[model samples]
Target: MARLDIKRKRVALTRELARLKHDLQARELDLEIQCRAMQDTLGELEESRSRYAELYDYAPVGYLTFDAKGCITEINLTGAAVLGMERTRLIGMPMSVFIDKGSCQLFFTHLRSCRLTGKKVTTEVKLAPKNAAPIHAQIISMPLPGGKGYGSQYRSIIADITERRHMEQEMLRMDRLNLIGEMAAGIAHEIRNPMTTVRGFLQTFMRRQEFAHIQSQLDLMLTELDRANAIITEYLSLARNKPVDQSLQSLNKIVADLLPLMESDALLHAKWVVAELPDSLPELRLDAQEIRQLLLNLVRNGLEAMAPGGRITLRTAVEDNQVVLFIQDQGPGIPAEVLPKLGTPFVTTKEDGTGLGLPICYSIAQRHHAQIEIETGNCGTTFIVKFPYPK
Candidate 1:
């Protein structure tokens, strides 16, 4: 009986040991599965971090972080590019160093407002980068929480508004041009009819032998009348509502056809005309006559701006899906004060200029959906007419 009882206890102990071993194996498998899931989650987190970094670095506008002391603590790649410096070098630099001399006070005031109010503040200032042209920047800044022993930090976003400002000015100029055009359209025909009658009577009188002694005098009056009529014709051209006959035409061909006339004008002025036209270019929807007139006006202006020995270059290029006509002259630059009023009627840099030429050019460009941009410096001035490709 004692031997049987000892055998039963041994069997029961073996069964209990086997059950514990099975439970331990199940727990090990569960831990292994969880470890794999954790590894996958870590990989996803790292990928998300990389994606965010790319978005921050390559944003269109600039991003900057300023510390409490008004120094740059962090800057993105775009900000570095805008400042014309490397990101590493811009760190910890005073932002005032990059601000235009005239805008430093304004910047300080903007900074102070954000810090004092601990709220959003905005300001427009000119950024004078060492290697790039001055940028018209609009900054929107907001205060951030500061750490222990530090004042309020700030986050700044900088946007380039140069193009927007230019567009506003252009719109304003267009309004002025339209006003002049309306006035010209109303009065041009009325003025030309009476002048025509006066010219006809003057010509008839010149033919009479009795008035032969005063023939020279009558001729001068006739000449003056003709000049007045020519001026009126230009005024009619300035009418912005004038219809344009646009067709698919080769700009290069038009330019080639006008080379002879342009050369003659240059020669008359004892100047040189050089053509740098491309062999081929995209066809533009344009009015042939108006394009010719536009080219002639720009070329004439270039020639007049230059000295006798100077050269005017007519260049045609394709840029950014647009055809660009460049009339460059080797002349002293246009006056700074006169640049803003360039397209206005009767505003001319030349003493004898009617100031009607450029206004007419502007009017034609608008009718053809083109833009005229001027680039002038001490070296010379270039008139750029950009014509967009057909939609």
Candidate 2:
């Protein structure tokens, strides 16, 4: 009995030792899993911080962080450059100091409204340079929702919009073309009928044998007569005082149909053409042929403006219930001084060019109840044709 009692105690001790070892292993595994989770969370937080840092440090536009009292707290390099001061110098300064004198109240009102209602305000703001003329900017004020416990941070974004303002001025100049088309209506119609009568009489007289030597002269007269008729026809189209033959036509299809002709001309001039058109465009009521012709004139002018090996970009989009086509070109854009003469009849760059092209485009827009806007600069020129959707 003593021997049996010793064996049983030994077995019980062995089993207890194994149970303790298993418990220790399980505790170590739990600790390792928790440590791994913490590491992963720390990595994610670091990545998020890096992204925010990049956005704050290198933003392309002016970025300014301010308090409700209009005190600048932080600003990006772009913002500092715009304010004509160093980043450190601007941190504690009043933001109003940077505002153009005439626009201080406007900036103040926008800042107040954004902070109070958490809304955004954007518009043109002029800022005087330290040693130069004033610069125009498009300012956007946004309320940066405060941190979990902090509620006093708001920021504003500003971009140099001097180029855009210049574009608007260009569009205003092109608007004059609309008036020239209005003047050509009667002259176009009256001259067309007389041209046809003159052509018929000249053709009959030129076929006579008695006038052999003068036949060549008659031929020259006939050629000039034809040229005159063509001019009248073009003018009539320009004075598009007619109604639209509305039909459901796809814009993409229209572009496709004209592609071959458009490409041929562009290729002959050694121009690079890019068409950013979709497989389909929304069908709308339009006089398709007229619109095509309008596009042709604009594209042709673009091709002519540049020498060999130039670039043209064509794109279309839908905005504000209107079909807008953008035709752009890389060329020395229209000079601001001479841009105003674009659509006046007989005003042209080429020796034999008639300035009626743009005016005709304007008349086409009027007939379709559309609007055309032209924007040009050293980089390029873009013509936007806005076709409205009938409600």
Worst 10 residues of 2 by lDDT: 173-182
* Runs in model 1 lying further than 4 Å from the true structure: 1-10, 116-118, 146-151, 193-228, 276-283, 317-321, 333-341, 374-380
- Residue 264 in candidate 1, Cα distance off native in Å: 2.5
TM-scores for every predicted model: 0.84, 0.53
Candidate 1 per-residue lDDT, tens place, 3-22, comes to 99999999998998898888
lDDT of 2 by residue, 125-182 (tens): 7887565567788778888776632327677788888778766764564455444444
Overall lDDT per candidate, in order of appearance: 0.88, 0.79
What clash count goes with each model? 0, 0
Native RMSD of candidate 1 (Å): 3.5
| After superposition, candidate 2 runs with Cα above 4 Å error | 1-190, 212-216
- The residue pairs that clash in candidate 2, if any, are none
